[model samples]
Target chain A: MQLNESDLSWRSLPGTLPVRHAVVSREQLLLLCRDVAGRGARLVSLWGEDRRAAGVGYVLVVVLDLTSRLLLTESISRSPNPGFPDLSQLFPSAGRMQRATHDLLGFNFLGADARPWLRHSAWAKDAYPLRHDFVAAAVSAPPLPTEIYPFVRVEGDGAHEIAVGPVHAGTIEPGHFRFSVVGEKVLRLEQQLGYTHKGIEKRFEGLSVQQGSKLAARVSGDSAVAYAWAYAMAVESLTDTQVPARALALRALLLERERLANHLGDLGGIGNDAGLSFGLAQFSRLKEDLLRVNATVWGARYLFDEILPGGVATDLAPTALPILLDSLAAMAAEVAVLQDIYDNHAGLQDRFHGAGVLSAKLARQLGVVGLAARASGQAQDWRAALEIPPYDGFAIGSVLAEGGDVAARVAVRFDEIAESLQVCRGLLTDLPSGEISVAVGKTRADELAVGGIEGWRGPILVGLRVAADGRIARCHPHDPSWLNWPALEHAIIDNIVPDFPLINKSFNLSYSGQDL
Target chain B: MWKILKQIVRTGLVTEPAPNAEPRLLEHALHADIHRLFGRALCIRQVDAGSCNGCELEIHALSNAYYNLEGLGIKFVASPRHADALLVTGPVSKHMADALRRTYEATPEPKLVIAVGDCAACGGVFGEDSYAGLGRIANVIPVDVTVPGCPPTPTALLQGILAALQSPTSRVDKRSASTYQKTEDRG
Candidate 1:
């Protein structure tokens, strides 16, 4: 990708993925983002780090996904008042990240939304949790009189606001949604998240790389396998550790199992949300069957600690192969039968078709990545496309769907499930033989590495930095929900308030993943 | 239509045998006690006070045909007002601490508060109280039971719910359940 302005130095970061880095001035930062957006690159994640101890002041870093490679743009603010020019104008997803950076490190974005994003009046006004100098007492000062969030008022002939929680009706993480509506037709939707931010980023400091992986796996529990793999990849890259082939193959299997589990569960959840309790009953049973197999084969219903730094902690035994294969065979046939039921059932089809349509143009504009983007006809699956590890050796065809509605998302989920089943079967039969793990050597100080894995939801990227004392200096495990949550706000533009949960289940974005 | 029926009939009732959550616990005793105590029904309200949703996944599994929580007379409702038990997941995040407190307050009395994950029980890998959260469900409200696992399995979850129903200690708020706390002296 060509930059708008020439004559800039680029440093290639050492990793399995193709990533390049460059430091720029405030003026150049704006220019670079504008150029990246113009060239179809999207802002994957934007986070700030307090670097005052190293002579550098607050640093703003944004990971831009170039499809083939990742571009890291760093803007170091050295002045008394450290700030960077806002990139929200070029990328809509940049707005929330900018506000979050501001709240954590006390950085001012000249042209960004100044309202609080993650800081729900949890701490004092001058408290900057991410700053190098900040230290919290045993008891944090009582949150300032709950700061008023000024949701844009929509006044009209029959407009009314329906406020839903930080504590919702369902067994889901906390986040507030304010829907401006006329009766049931939604005029607009605004989300206030960050109710689950439990100091994960701050907690990363001083944790050994081993402990960091355990913590990262929990950042968003549903994607435990994916996050653990991403952390392992980052640590391996930083330490120049070469993971074994068997471990890599097993990791791919664990990740695919995770994908299969979530898709099966969400497909059921979507059906249940659409008033088909039968769908919930059948699909969830299949998911339960798969999970029992997971526990039997891998020793955990959820694959959390399986992927380690140098390799994987668990290995597949020859005897367990038949069990895994048999379960997949049964699930594949049952899923096809259910797909037929979903397709021909008039009532279910009516609800799924043309409900919550997010135009591909808008989805691309909003930088929506992963399955949601795929449903909207934005074909980008990093693992299969970029050929991540063992996946590069497999036969994986692209899975895409048009319409960007609940139906399309359902279609994509079914297609992804089918493909993942194939991938898992292939990995099992052609299972490689080697040591599952090895020791990760000493990590040099002040080194940073990036790991981007295409998690079931979307691309989950881990930006890990090694401290001078060989502990975690800073770790930003970003969830794709950051880019997709705003898209959900836009997707519900005119859908009925009642259809909100159904439409929402189709996306099923992670609240804790983003809140963290 | 036929496909749906056939799948349902083929799947059948895969719900495990009685006392599935923890096999050692006598199901006849707990099931009969539940029938007598709550009239063969227990309505629960699950709150994600702020742990990773690992616990919620297992909680959702409770409703599957394999667990058949509904058949056991336990149902997850939409509002805390209808709840007889509150299943709080995760270490209480600061932003969620207040909302969680309000949820506990809304649930009807003789209600049980069961912490569903290790984080909810005693602050998991993410650790305890800080600027961002008040670790563990007990930090925010009285905990009747702590179902501890990184994310407790569905079977463990069922046991936790049943244990809460049977334990006389659970009937009283943990603050006032001091009399039930046995002395170390064995007096």
Candidate 2:
């Protein structure tokens, strides 16, 4: 790996290699990122580090160049004047990410546009929880209640603001969205999250590697497999543990099922929001059925803790074999019918077609990854990019759609669902016979490994550092939501407000995933 | 529009049933199978009491494309009042504790509560870690079924939900349920 002039690179390090290197300089960091990004390197995540183990505070970044499939890392210390080059001017999405890091880790991204991303009154303005001197359960000074956020306004008569939920009318996660709208046409939408900030990252300190995977799984409950697999990949890479072929195949199957299940539900929900009751009812029911079979076959409908450090927990039972095949067959027919309905319904088409348009340029500039990225023609999928197990064996297709609208996103989901179904069938046919998990054995102290898995969302990268005692020094499971969430704002531009749900549902990102 | 309506009718309005309503044939076939084996189909309503949304995801997946829990006639209802079973995900946060209680109270008696995932079963990671809210789902609501994966796979959730709906009166058999909960409990 080529190191930036101000940055250092190390292959095998004293700590985990996944911790990589500290960049040291503040000015050339963005210049470095611009060069790397120009080389087709995908920005994984940028976060602040204020933990005591590092002596001084630092800013961290993880970047992946899809072309070469290598991760580029950088860090700059705060004691040496805690500031870093701002990549936000070049990559606007980097702004929110840098702001989150700044808010949490206390490292200011100089000249970077700072917005409150996941910094929603979890603490007062000066409070930073991840700091080394920070107390976990301290009864400190009573925090002043924050004022109502000054949401951006749209100029018009009768253009009132409606703030909806950290609690919602439905059984969804907590997020407060302030809508500036004239009647049903929304002029501005600002989101307030962190209502469910579980302090997962802060809690990871002093935990054993074995213990951290569980925390990773809960990062975003819906993307449990994705997060868990990413964490495991990081740990396994640090430990240099090779998962069995069958285990790899099974992971792919589970991930695909996850992708299909979420897509089906979202497709249905988006339809429901648009008043396509038939599509909503049918798709939701189909999603339910699919999940039930997933439970029967894999044992859990959502396939959460199934991904262990070394491999999967339990293999498919013999009795579940044909049942799995049968379920897939049945779903294929249902998907075909659903696709037909989605294709022919004029009302559904009208609402979805031009709604929530994220143009190709905006999508790229924002660095949005996952289906939202694919919908806008970014054409990035970690499955195909990073060679990992079964996905490496097969020629993974990166589905691309230029529309970048709700309909385009839905179409991408449908296409991906079809592809995932095919992958499931292939895994079933080529089901390898072997032990599901091999013992992860004692990891060497000071070992670092990087593991990336193409989760249902996109690529989940797990960067792990092991202390000498096998305890975790640092574990970062970067969810795709951090990049995708900001894209939601830009995508909603020019579109009327009533279609927000359709737009939001189309890009159903995880607030909890990113908050942690 | 009427012509389109006629077309939709002709096409049978091709759609899946509500969460847990078995496809027509499976419902018919499983009705006797389930009756002879466990007892009868159970109606389930899922409530999210401030979970990480992972458990609810698995709970939601228990009915989607791959698993199709509807084949067993077990269904997720829109209201707790109309349901016999409660599937709750997440670690009942303080913010959601009141809503969860009201939801549980809203459900009629003979209700079975299936705490899905480590969070719901025992608050998993967020239980003792976060300051945002309360502890386990069982702390706020009575749990009759503990399906414990980090986010139990759809099949695991299905079996646990089906098992809960099946015996209806069975002691929360976490043995079969805990298979997936082997992951570390940061809670």
Model 2 share of native interface contacts: 0.33
**Chain A structural similarity (TM-score) per candidate?**
0.98, 0.91
Candidate 2 docking class: incorrect
Off by over 4 Å in 1: A1-6, B20-28, B172-187
lDDT tens digits by residue: candidate 1, A1-516: 345734568788776777888888778878788887888988899999988887877788888888888887778898756788888889999899988888888888997899888888677666788887887662456555567798988999999999999889898878999999998899999999988988899899889999999999999999998899889888988888888889999999999999999999999999999989999998999899999999999889998898989999888888899999999999999999999999998999999998999999999999999999999999998897667888898776489998999999999999999999999999999988989998999886776688888999999999888987889989999999999999999999889998999999999999889888
Counted clashes in each candidate structure: 1, 56
Tens digits of per-residue lDDT, candidate 1, B38-117, equal 66578999999887889999999999988888877788999999988899997888888788889999986667899988
Judged by DockQ, which candidate is best?
A: 1
Residue range B10-86, candidate 2, lDDT tens digits: 54633344335555654575576445433666667777665778666656545543455665566666677777678
- Model 2 lDDT tens row, A404-485: 9999998998999888888889899889898888878777664345666767776677667677788887676678888888
Q: What is the TM-score of each candidate against the true structure?
A: 0.96, 0.79
